[model samples]
Structures are given as C-alpha cells and as structure tokens.
Target: MLRFDPKGPRKNDLSSWRPDVVQIWSIGEFRANWATASDTRVGYTAGGAIAFLDVTDGTLLRSSIIESNSAATGGGILCEGSSPHIVGCEIARNGAGFGAGIRSEGGAPLIQDCSIVSNQGVVYSAEGAGGGIASGSGGLVVSRCIIADNYGADTGGGIFLWPESRAHIVQCLITGNDTCWCGTFGSGGGIMCHSDFATITNSTIADNSACISGDGIEISGSPTITNCVVWNRIYVRRGNPRITYTLTKHPRSGEGNIVADPRFRGGGDYRLQALECGGPGISPAIDAGHPGVEDADLSCDWGLGGSRSDMGAFGGDGAGIRCNPCIQVFGIPEMVEYGDVLNPVILATNLGTFDALVAVVTGPIDTTIPLYRGPPIDVAPGDSVVLERELRIVPSIPAGLYRCDVDATLRGEFVSRGVFETILQDD
Candidate 1:
C-alpha cells in the first residue's frame, strides 16, 4: 500500500528516468493526491488499485480506481493531450468539478470494457459537467462499457462532449444517471453532446433523469445515433441528428425507428426477452436493429433466430454474453382435429460456454394447461438435444385456431419460447 498526503505538492515528480514502459503490477493500493506529471508510458495491471492518476500516455488494464476527490477536473483520471487505452477497469465514487471519473482534454483515448459508476461532478462556480466522462477537444472511443449511477451538478450526468470533440460510443450501457443543480439548470441526464461530431451505436441509454430536459440525451451539434435504445427523452436544442433503426419511448422521424417498450429482463439484466427463452413475452427490440450489423455470436439478431440485429448494448459485435440453450420448436402440426392426439418435437441447443440444465413444457399460448412436461436434461456447450411430446386435443374444446407454445426452462425458469398456430376443427 502506498499513500500520499493531501498536503504534498500539487505537482510531484515520481521518477526522473523516462522508461519506455512503466508497469505497476501486484500492488495492493495507491492513494495519491495529485496527478502524475510524466510523459512516460505507464501501465497498471490487475491486483492493483489507484485512487487517482493524471495520465499522459499509458494503458491501464483490469485495475480499480475509487473514492478519489479533486477540486478541479478528473478526480480519478485527468488525460491532457494524451491517448490512453483504459480497459477492463472499474472507476467509481470519485468527485471533481468536471469529469469526475475521467477528463480528456486532447488526443484520442480508447476506453473499453470498463465500469464507470457512482461518480459525482460538483458545481464549480456554475461550471459542472460529465459526471462519468468529459471530452474537451479530443476523439474519444468508449466501447462495451457500463456508465451508471453518476450525478452531474449541471449537465451530462453520464458523459459530456465539449465543442470540437468527437466521441464514438458503441455497445455501452448508460443508465440510472442524473443531472440537476438548484432544480433549474440540469439537462442531458445520460449524455450531453455539444461536440462537432458524435456517433453512437448499439448502446442502451435508459432510466436517466434531468432537472430540466433531455433525460436520455441532449444534443447541441450534429450527431448520428443508430441501432440504439433510448428509454428516456432526447431533446435537441440545436442541430439535427440522424437516428435510424433505434428504439425510443417517443417516435422520432427516422428509418426503422420504433416506439415500444424494450421489455428488458428485469433486475439490471438489460437483455431483451425472447419468449422461447422463458420470458413472459418477446421484446420488440429483439431483431430490430440495423441490417448490416451482427452480434458477437455471429448472429445478426443476438442469435435469437433473426435476420437483423438487436437494438441495445447486448447487440452488435461487442455484446457481453451469448444466449444459452437457444431452443427451437419444430414438427408441430399446422392443422388438427378435435380429440386427436398430436406429437410435437423441439430442439434445444446450448450455445453458451457452460453446460445447462433445461426442461421442456408445451401448452396453449398464455395458459397453464401443460400438454407435456419433460424431465431435466443436461446440455453441454455446442450440443443439441431433441425432445418429443404427445399432446391430446380435447373434443369438448371449442373449434378455432389456437397457438401451441413450447417453452424451454433453464433451471426452473423459462428462458425461451416457440409457437405454432394450429387450426382445430370438430370433424
């Protein structure tokens, strides 16, 4: 453990030798007050923690930075004219007047697979922005990250893009962020974009709240959003954004845009529900993304048997997880007579890495009338199993077109569903 006193000089010289690479590994913790003013390249590996660091150029991987406080910008990381590759790290509970988690002034920075959460941007003489990140004149790429539960005093609870900055956000989740100040000055709870050009794709921005407007995103300059999900409001004060194949609460004028509930798996699981996977219903966001994109599983629509991609962070090439036990129903009769016994077959394939315990249940759509229930079957990764069930149609039942549903349960929870329509006639 290394601790630096707050009373130390605001700028300290840690080392004089300009090494080609400085690797800090296996350290327990580092509590520093001021930023490291070195142009030398640095890398912090796993098993180490940093309270704060001023990064000029470096790569930080699998580290933790938490609870640092700064009176100025970037309580956790201040990047000045430096392009650092920060990946697989957790940055949380930091405070600063601007960019509590990270502040990039110039140069292109790549932040990937990180969690920026619970940071606060304090008001500094009416100047506060970017609770999670602030990009001031730079090209920043944030990919496959979760930025959540951050607070901004003025605007941009999750991220702020200053003028002349360009940010490319892909396959990220920004949620539960807030922006407020004296109940009158807040905006852009998820993202406040004033940059020259910003492009957001395959991301999920939801449950953000602002004091004034733009609970999901507030745009001042031209930005392009595609194949994303915005559960909250998006207010454009200036400039027009090209939004396409996106899902929003309110309908926006764009190609493939839809207004519907994303039906996210509850309890912080942002994955869209597929009834075949034991969800109560299918989410409209499933398979409703850009046609050109593909998920990590090489499936166009999150591997749920869709031609197009999904519209959320779980879609695209950087999706977090693969679908387990992708069940498909087949051999269901299209027409049947009353009092006839029918046989249906279903195939369950394990697409995930681990083995899965699965069961099969067949019944009428939205009913508890289980026609057949199979015993638990163990499925290994990349393996498939076929199950058959006999379903008898009662003669006393009314003659009509009915939907027979096959639900696959994983560890007692339904995760997938398959349905086929059958015309039942009394003959």
Candidate 2:
C-alpha cells in the first residue's frame, strides 16, 4: 500500500522524475489524494490518481487505482503528450468532469488487457463526457479490455473520441455503459466517435443505454467498423461509417451484415452460444464474421462449420475458448464501523473450461490492518469456493470509504482480483 498525497503540481511530476518504467506488480494498491475547494473550476486540476505529462514512453503494469476524485479531468489517469503502455491494471470508482477512468490528449497511448469499470463522469460540473475514456487529438490503441458499467453525463458513456483522434479498438467488450441527458445533447451509450480516423474490429457492444439515441454507437465522422456485434441502435449524425461483417438488430447495408439475435449466454456473459454444448440454440453470430479471418484455435465455430471468424470479442486471432480458468470474486460488505469484526465470506468461482489447480486468497490492504491470507483450495470448472476470513477494524483507522482488494492466485499466478468498497464510520 503506497499512498501518494500530492500538495502541488511538482509532487507527481513524472516527466521530471523520468523513470523508464513505472511498474506496480502485485503491490496491493496505489492511491492519490489531492483535495480541492468546492468552487474549483473545470480544467484547473487533472489526474486525481496520476498525471503523465510530456513523457515520451513509459509502462504502467498490473496496478489498481480506485475511488479517486478529481476536480476537473482524468480522475484515474491523465496523459498529456505521453504515450505509455498501460496493461493489466484496474481503474474503477473514480470521478471526474471528463474521462473518469482516463483522459489522453496529444499522445499515442496503448491501453491493453485492462479493466475500466464503474467510474463516474461529470462530477463537480454540469456536463461531463467519457465515463471510461476520453481521447483528443491522439492515436489511441485499446485492445482486449473490458469497459463496463460506466456513467457519463453528456455523451460517450464507454468511450468518447474527439475530432482528429485516431482510435483503434480491437477485441474488446463494451457493455452496460450509459449516458445521461435527453434529446440531441446525449448520444452514444457505448461509444461516441467524432473522428474520421477511427477503426473498431472484432468487438462486442451490447446492453448499453442512452437517453435519446445511439444506444450502441454514435458516429459523427466516417469511421470503419468491422466484424462486431452491436446489440443496440447505431445513430449516424454526419458522415457515413463503413460497417461490414457485423451483427446488429436492424438490417444494415453491408456485405456480410445480419439482422438477428446474437443468442448470447445470459447472466452478463456475452459469449455466443453453440448447440453442441447443450446450449439453448446456436447463435447466428457464430462463424459469421469476415471470410478472411479465423479464431485463435485455427478453426472457426469449434469445427461445427466453415473456417471463418466469429463476430464478437471472443474471436479473431485471440484467445477463443481456450483451456483457462476464469475466476470471479464476490461477497464483500459495503459498510463497516470501528471496533467491528467483519466475517467476510469471499466467494471465488471458476467459470472457465479448465480446473484451477490451487486457489489462494490474499490481502485486504489497509495501513493499520494486518494482512491476512486464507488457505488454499482447488476449484473445478463451473465451481465455486467460499474463502471465509475475519477482518477486525481498529479504532485508529480513519472514517471514509476505502477500496479493499481480494486477489485469487493459482499456482503462483494471479487468477482474478476483486475490489469492494467499505465505508468505515466512527461509531
């Protein structure tokens, strides 16, 4: 647990420090606290967690920054003229006027294998945009990431691409994001692209909501979308987008477009169903992608049909139905008080096809609390285990909402990580 309390601009100046790589591997958490006045204006402050300014190249890996608040922009991370490789990190529960998870301007940043979830936009201001990410005048590459459950006040609940920003989104899942405001002001619940140089491929944009229009994608420029599964509406405001080999609810004018239900695996799992595995029915999106592409297993549709790609995030030269254990952690309380003993029952579920060898639970990561680790247990596929532990809250701990992380490890490798908020009160 490393606490970063920035008093002024010179405190978190990474450009002056000039570190080659800023790696945070397996370190429980890194938090930044920079408080501001209530009447602070927008654009006055940025990067509630970190600010990368004028840095040419860097790497940020395997870190967790959560629940930070900014007065203006980039509540989790702010990149200005810096192209850093941010991978396998979690940026969630942060608040800002724009880009609640990240704000990139004038630099080509590569964001890969990260989770940007449950962040809030438009805090301390009336109109905010880009709850997950906001890019402006830069070339951004987002790959194999999960951007979900974010909220934006104005537009682009999942991602907002400004004019002249070239963003290439590939093999990502954008779901359950939302935008507020009604009428012509609000649009693009999944993504709002104002750039003509954007390209989206092999992605799944589903279950997004907007107040007025563009529940899946809103384009004001001529971007190209290919081999995607858009389960909602797509509103075009200005230029026409070249959409091909995609699956949507409405009939689109493309070479390989289909208007049908994707028959996704329910319970928030957006994978296309196959009838060979006792599924309800075969998904039309299975083996319905571009004719030139193929899955990572060198076969499409799991040997059920032709060797074309599937039309979703799980397809296209990536990990498609591999033998890996996908673990999920849950069951943490939301509130606690001082001098209270918490019997937190952490549940770990293996949702993958393979069996997890050994599951180990570690840490609650507080300054005043002693670290705890649970016993190891094996979890089979589609099975769950309850790691029961007792956490004692001392009187010396402060009273505020804090993020407590629980990590599951399998054979010395990280399987999954879960974050929960606990509000400590002075009873």
TM-score to native of every candidate shown: 0.66, 0.67
How would you encode candidate 2's per-residue C-alpha lDDT over 1-427 as one tens digit per residue?
1212222244533343334433333334655544343212224677776666655433444445445555377888777766666666788877787888888886566676789998888735665789999988666677778999998878999999897776778789999999986455568999999977677888999999999789899999977788899998999989978889999988889889999999887899887777675678988988889887766554423322445788889776452134233322222334567777644433344433212323232234344332334434554443333333356778876777776555555445666654556677657
The C-alpha RMSD of each candidate to the native structure, in angstroms, is: 18.8, 19.2
Give every collision pair in model 1.
275-416, 275-417, 276-416, 276-417, 277-415, 277-416, 277-417, 278-414, 278-415, 278-416
Separately for all candidates shown, the number of backbone clashes (residues 3 or more apart, or on different chains) is 10, 0
> What is the alpha-carbon lDDT for the whole of candidate 2?
0.68
Query: For residues 1-427, what per-residue lDDT tens digits would candidate 1 score against the true structure?
Result: 1211122322334343122342332222333343332311223210012222333323333454444545367767666555455666677877777888887766556676789999888896567799998888655667778999999999999999986666678789999999999998899999999864667889999999999999999999867788999999999999877789999999899999999999988898787888777788888987788776655563323545464678888776443234354554433344567776544434444533222323233334234445334444454453334344456877766677776555655455665555556677658
The candidate maximizing TM-score is: 2
- Relative to the true structure, how large is the alpha-carbon lDDT of every model? 0.67, 0.68
Q: In model 2, how large is the Cα lDDT of residue 296? A: 56
